[model samples]
Target: MRKSKLMVFIISVVVMSLLMVWDMPKVFDNINLGLDLQGGFEIVYEVSPLDGKSEIPEMSAVSKSISKRIDVLGVNEPSIMIEGENRIRVQLAGVQDQDQARRILSSTANMSFRDVNDNLLMDATVIKEGGATLAFQNGIPVVSLKIADQDKFYEVTKELATRGEGKNLIVTWLDFEEGVDSYAKEMEKVAKGEEPAYVSAASVREGINGDAVISGNFTDESARELADLINSGSLPVKMNELYSNVVSAELGEGAYEKTMIAGIIGYIAVVIFMIAMYRLPGVISAFMLFIYLWAVLKVYNLMGGVFTLPGIAALVMGAGMTVDANVITFERIKDELYKGRSVKKAFEEGSQMAFSSIFDSQFTTLIAALVMYWLGTGSVKGFATMLMITIVGTLLITVQVVKFLLGLLVSSGWLDNKKTWFGVSAKHLPDVAKGEERKYFGKFHNVDFMAIFKKVSLLPVAILVIAVAMGVFNSVSGNGFLNLGIDFASGTKITVQSDAPLTVDAIEDKFEEFGYQVSRVQLSGDNNEMASVSIKEVIETEDMYELKEALEAEYGYEPSDSVVTPVVGRELVRNALMACAVAWVAMLAYISFRFKFDYAISCIITLMHDVLLILAIYAIFRIEVESTLVAVVLSIIGYSINSSIVTFDRVREILDGKENAKNPKEYYKTVVNEALRNTGERSLITTITTALPLIALIFLGSPSITGFNTSMLVGILAGAFSSLFLAAPIWYTFRVNKKPTQKKQKNVKKLDEPTEINVPGINS
Candidate 1:
């Protein structure tokens, strides 16, 4: 025991030291700020052909084109990706001037050369479709254009002439391509009143079909546009801007302040609760919890974790888990007290008894966290990573710091009297008041074990198995293992607020006339005054203007506000999942290395069950799986495993006791029952307490956080259930054999008499 205590001390000190030295504060300081926390431009575009055939593939192409254009615009960390199948959501970070971003994004890069008779000479299509050879030799630009099919060329050229001139005559091109300067120079000569003459040039390309060398004096913009046009062929789809907004950082400031205040209040409340519950021991536990918080923060900072609103919530949740460990330990002390043990003996035995449970619970929560971190994308993964880190920190503080301090207090005679402080009296000690061990904790020897263990409860097992099977079905059925949000798939989101109520069907008809395939249009605002129109394609600037005009024409009033754009795409989704998965797997492997294999296995199983159950619930409810779901899963995983570790620690204690005459099955049952008795109230209370704020968020928070809260509510329930029912039961089945081991037999010595100790307390 001494050696174990010393080992824990050494490990904690080393870990904490390393964390501090790594400058966690600086690391967290550099984390990427989210769009809400930082000022940025958000543009929603509808991508569809003027003909409006849904044009999903065409919309994807337009999104890519626009993204490339934005990239060339040099907006810092531009988030230009496809949303759903129709919209393109573009976010430009650090873009303070919304108008500038809009102008840059909206400016159509259309380039063309027209003849004096208003005939189309060349356009983006001509450059893209034409087999052109480009080379720069001795400072002279040369482009050999080959027109294999002249019939299609004439039709394209005729269409270009009808599109207008002056600003419209500009030739659009991709950036940094070969032969654009040469083409521009040739066009410049024609613009300079040169005679219309056909020049047959075969030196540029020997055996090419029909070749023309375009050379003229061209400006940098014109040349670049020409290059861009050549590189990116004409977009098959036209963009209609459905929505645009430049959300300032100010919106997040209030949320940040509220979160901070709430966190502080929550921290204080948890500490008070802990201290009030267990008196001196509780005080020590509270102190350790504070340290745990500090350590977790430091680690988060050191690891460069960005503290978003969801991240802050995760921190609070982690604090609750930290308090949970103390609750387990204190309850164990109460149990020991009920066993007619001395204060010192109760303290030692309780702490010892609580260790395995705490470890198991935490380990399981960590596993779930890992899965969240594994499968989750974006903010979800971020939350999971932080929660996992804090869980580790909490374990260290609980098992080592809290335990050590409590031991020191008892060893130094600080807690010699049971009725010393905080209104706790001898009556509060369950052991002294009862004068015997409780039925659950009393030693079981020479019992008819076969008779008692004859029947196995298959009901719980059946339910669990069914749940697992359902989860597997969901995984294969394409409802998905995790809910994927619009942030990953490209789509359009149009928020329209009008003075009067409007049905989704009415709005759908208006958009459908404009050739947009409306997917799911739902009325969103209170009093049915606002409508959220989700389309298969992004709505562009022209689309928005037309929609506004149509709305005014139909309802005699335009929408007071509106924003439309595409969702995120596969790339960002892939990255988010990778980040989460890596975090989870790493944590799992780490836990396995740090603890025993059985401990690791229990954690993983509990986590899997929690995740699967959450998925099943979501599937049953038919909630769209999105990024927020990922955050919920991560948070729940941490919470659930934290509970499992607590139970496992208690089981370890019972098994480690001197009077372990029961077989593994009996020992497991005793531990499971004890764990429930010890942590049942704490788990329930903590989960309820933690869930309250989330519930509040669900009712009052913004749309962004609503998803997160919903996920948390479901995940928390699933996590708690799995921790209590699945973690230990599965662990016992796998690790503990049907028969008692030699080590167990040796540990149970048939004592003739009970040992006694004398202290200053009146009871003996």
Candidate 2:
């Protein structure tokens, strides 16, 4: 209450100036562009070679080979990696034409050469069928072959020998750059009757098995083609494309525009509502809120945080929460004024009283955001990032920025005691009659502290037990953790827009026939204008074309484009884990610096609980552990922390009031109860506001978005519970010690009077 106006103004200016200097344009440029925003093609390829006969090692080898081939294609920032057991995802950025991409990608490069008149030469089948002999002569492995037409074979062999002079025939083991290469000189020396060479035509191996190995000047591409040809061979297992579509970057840009516009409009509306409802205090609060928004954007820009559609939505949601602290403070001030307290006394008491509520509410939100960042990936992570930033930004703006501004305004007599802003006047308000404060149930009872501690600890212990039990059951049941989405696990994703409605099951069945492990299929696009099918493995370009054709034939609608793929696998998982860990640690550091160590510890503990609980549920329910899960977990962390912080702020206030006190048990208890009681309504309101949009998203969003929503819904609810039950109780246990005193006895007596405890319209 005794804050310096000059100091407050200087701090605000300094913070604002710093934020402005940190690339304001870049910050407001819109959310970070996703793959969808940047034009690209994503394709999922199934790496199983002919039926299910391939071994894990063989499949792994094939995956490596295919990845090398895609890398050779030189797509910008291309992502080509394995996913799950036998899946490969390839993402090509800035690919405008799907047909060209498909053509390049689908052309099975089975590079093989034949005689001039099309006579049968060495092929991949020779090794598999006839078991060609390999012998070491002169310390060199000699691969010998026998052909049906010896004369024609000799001519081809001689040509190869002659061409071998200075060049080496590089037989890429599987066409990779690291494959084996043999010098043509060695073959020439043996063919020309010089002496036994590294490779001899002595017919040491026999049988016309349908092919022969050719080695020579094969550049990287040619080598790869040959390897692919040999590895794939000619097979009857043809691929049929299930669906494909071209996603226009224009759509993403449009979405970005609409989201920005909606956010601005919504923010403006909230500001207007606050000003009209609270008058001068509302105006000040609104200004502080604006500052909060600016700080969030600045921080986001400074940190290079990417904004997405969901991120934009989160920003809008955060805007609502940003003013919550101010509202609590203003309401308390009004209550004090109604009790006939002097303007200065009302302002002081109200701000002090509001701390608990504000901190609690914000802490809950912070916790939820943290959990989301931990468990989410991709766009969901983006949302979580924004939510977390906004919560922290709000704390700074509301607690420091707004509180200081309000103090300055009151001190400067800008808001006098006489003038009426909303309704009640300073003179007309009721006098503060002395009364007994209400006593909570069992507050004065001489209960055993140790017994209570044991009883309370049981809840967290039970949760831990349940979590462990579920984890064990999940491991034994063979229903591994959530089946991650493509954003995390990687695979093939195809979105098809049609004029008519289509069933997900029908499309899934069609894809299954094409030998695709169709994991998920759902209606996408506004008004069900499109259907998206995601599979466990990527589809080759040729297979994509085939699938598109099949769709056209069966569904009477041709796909507008070939499928696009994104890389998924170990690399993605590793990166996601690293990013989430970094975010969590960074959040902890920031919170520790902003608040006390105990508060930071409490926040982290609550966050961990929320995250673990979410994971436990996911493991229990067998939800797919995709990138969206990360988003949910991070969101939970942010929300839970927001609630905890509110309570801590109240504790700080109580500590400030009784600096000389030996024990702070009474202070902590009052703070906790007051914080929870005051902020309960706002907490419910904020939750509802956030929940409504998510509920809509669950019903209307794309499969990916719906998954994100589901995770968020669970996280939000868990975060709310953790804030009230877990965070506060834990904080009380850590900070307060039960001790009997005469002051406590006096307080208990004061609490027994009904007239002292009840505030009119409070329960109402």
Output the worst ten-in-a-row residue range by lDDT, candidate 2: 170-179
lDDT of 2 by residue, 47-161 (tens): 4344344444444565555554455455544555454455555556556566655544554433233322223344443344333343334444433333444455455455545
Candidate 2 lDDT (Cα, whole model)?
0.57
Candidate 2 structure, TM-score to reference: 0.55
lDDT (C-alpha) at residue 238 in model 2: 18
The most accurate candidate by TM-score is 1
In model 1, the worst 10-residue window by lDDT is 199-208
Please give, for residues 1-764, the per-residue lDDT of candidate 1 as tens digits.
55565565557656655765576456445555555555456667677553435444555567666776666456655666564467676766556556546645664544444433333445545543535445444565554455545555555444544554432232323221232334345456778987322221111112223434445443444334344434444455556675554434433443444444544565566567666766776666666665676677767756755566567558767777777777777766776665666778887887786676677667656765666566654455667788788778877766677777667556655555653342244543455454644444322222332233223334435555665565567789964543444444455555455667777777888778888876555453444555555554556788778877877777675443224332334544565556545655665675567555676677777777677667666655556665445556656666765776665655555556533454655766666566555556666656765665566556655443455567777788777666655666666676555344565444577789996767667655
TM-score of 1: 0.56
CA deviation > 4 Å runs, candidate 1: 1-33, 36-276, 279-304, 342-345, 352-381, 395-414, 419-425, 428-485, 494-536, 548-603, 656-671, 699-703, 732-764
